[model samples]
Target: MSQTTIQISQELQQELNRMKLFSRETYEEVIWNIIEDTKELSNEAKRDIAKARKEIAEGKAVTLSDLREKYKIQ
Candidate 1:
């Protein structure tokens, strides 16, 4: 792969260093992970979220407390 050098502030460099998963992790991997996390959700995921919200608003969803009581969980 082709490579290029770019300058970053010392603060930004330190932040990136802190984001590394391991001592050997590269800055590029950290950057790509940030990019992936900020990407938009897929259409299906969006629809599912909307459906779940509607169900919650309509009181069609069960509560965690109710499930715990039903299952005799403490």
Candidate 2:
């Protein structure tokens, strides 16, 4: 890989270092993990997920056989 140089404050460097799981992890990995973890879902998507989860938790989910029996589908 081609190498490039960038500069960050010592405080930022320390924060990145603290975020690392191991002493040998690269700053690139640390920054990428922070980036991936910071992803946000839309409000609508979040609401749908919450609703689906609640249905499953409340035993409101149905199997194909249950639906077939309920509707008496042949």
Candidate 3:
């Protein structure tokens, strides 16, 4: 893969360093993780979320309290 160099502020560099998952993690990996987190959900995921919301509105979805009572959990 081709590589390019870009300049960033010292503060930004420190911030990116803090975002690393491990000491050996590269800045590219950290930036990619951030990009992935901000990406829009897939069409299927969006549809599933909308369906879940509708079910919740219609009271078709089970509540945590209900599950606890049904399973005899305190």
Candidate 4:
């Protein structure tokens, strides 16, 4: 297969490295694995996500991280 080169920031590269499941997993495999996971979410969950995004765009929702911090979750 033909291959391509893309540039990513050092921080992003480190995050990708941290996501690797094994020493031999390639970047393509890692990206496709994430894509597969998003495709696996249920229709109800997907609709809820769409609704949440719309709410956030309307400035009507608190992000989970912010809510977690507000609740003092570790």
TM-score of each: 0.59, 0.56, 0.62, 0.52
Better of 2 and 3 by lDDT: 3
Q: What shift in Å separates residue 45 of candidate 3 from its native position after superposition? A: 2.1
- Global CA lDDT computed for model 1: 0.97
Q: Where does candidate 3 stray beyond 4 Å?
A: 48-74
lDDT tens string, model 4, 1-74? Answer: 99999999999888888899997899999999889887878999989999999998999988889998999997
Query: Which parts of model 1 are misplaced by more than 4 Å?
Result: 47-74
What residue pairs are clashing in model 4?
none
Q: Kindly give the number of clashing pairs for every candidate.
A: 0, 0, 0, 0
Identify the candidate with maximal TM-score: 3
Candidate 1 TM-score to native: 0.59
**lDDT for residue 64 in candidate 4, whole number 0-100:** 86
- Order the candidate numbers by TM-score, best to worst: 3, 1, 2, 4
Q: What's model 2's lDDT at 60?
A: 95
- Candidate 4's displacement at residue 43, Å, is 8.4
Q: What's the lDDT for candidate 4?
A: 0.91
Predicted candidate 1 versus true structure: per-residue lDDT over 1-74, tens digit per residue: 99999999999999999999998999999999999989999999999999999999999999999999999998
Clashing residue pairs in candidate 3, if any?
A: none
RMSD of each: 3.3, 9.9, 3.1, 8.6
Q: What local distance difference test score does each model get?
A: 0.97, 0.94, 0.98, 0.91
**Which one wins on lDDT?**
3
